[model samples]
Target: MTQADDLADEERRLRQLRLVVDITAQILAEDRHLTLCEALRLIEAARTTAGRLFPGRQDTFDLVVRPRLERIVLERFGIVSTAPVN
Candidate 1:
């Protein structure tokens, strides 16, 4: 693939990741019926989807994306802590 093609593909993957994260956040925030276990499962599913989309970028997802979802989960559930959640 040419450089432009590679750039386009990366951009597409980025958009997919963003969509996944946004949807997960929306669910975690708005779904009052969601339990803690369900929220954790959603986060895990998002991580798996992100891994499939970005291959070897798990660390990037954990560092950048996971925290955002975690924060929403914490706020929605009315919990606060510095300890690792998962």
Candidate 2:
């Protein structure tokens, strides 16, 4: 890829990462009843579902957002995963 292509890819990934963080934050904020751990789990579940159903940049925001936030708890929050990362 050309330098411009590489930069574009980086920018796209960064944008998606921001969207993922934003969605996770919103999820954490809106559901006050759930504990932090529970909310994190919810995000995980959403990620899994998105991976299976959407897989990647399909079109809709739901498809794009979910996988970007995927597995963030394990990577970001250091959650002990019962299963290995695939």
- The lDDT per prediction is 0.92, 0.59
Model 1: which residue pairs collide?
none
Residues 1-86, candidate 1: write the lDDT tens digits.
Answer: 99999999999998998999999999999998999999999999999999998898899989998888988988988897688657
Q: Candidate 2, residues 1-86: lDDT per residue as tens digits?
A: 99999888778766665666587756655554756578657666556544444456434445555444544544555457686556
Please give the clash total of every predicted structure, in order: 0, 0
Among all windows of 10 consecutive residues in model 2, the one with the lowest summed lDDT is 66-75
Cα RMSD, each candidate: 2.8, 8.3
Best by lDDT: 1
Angstrom error of the Cα, residue 50, model 1: value is 1.0
TM-score of each: 0.90, 0.44
Worst 10 residues of 1 by lDDT: 77-86
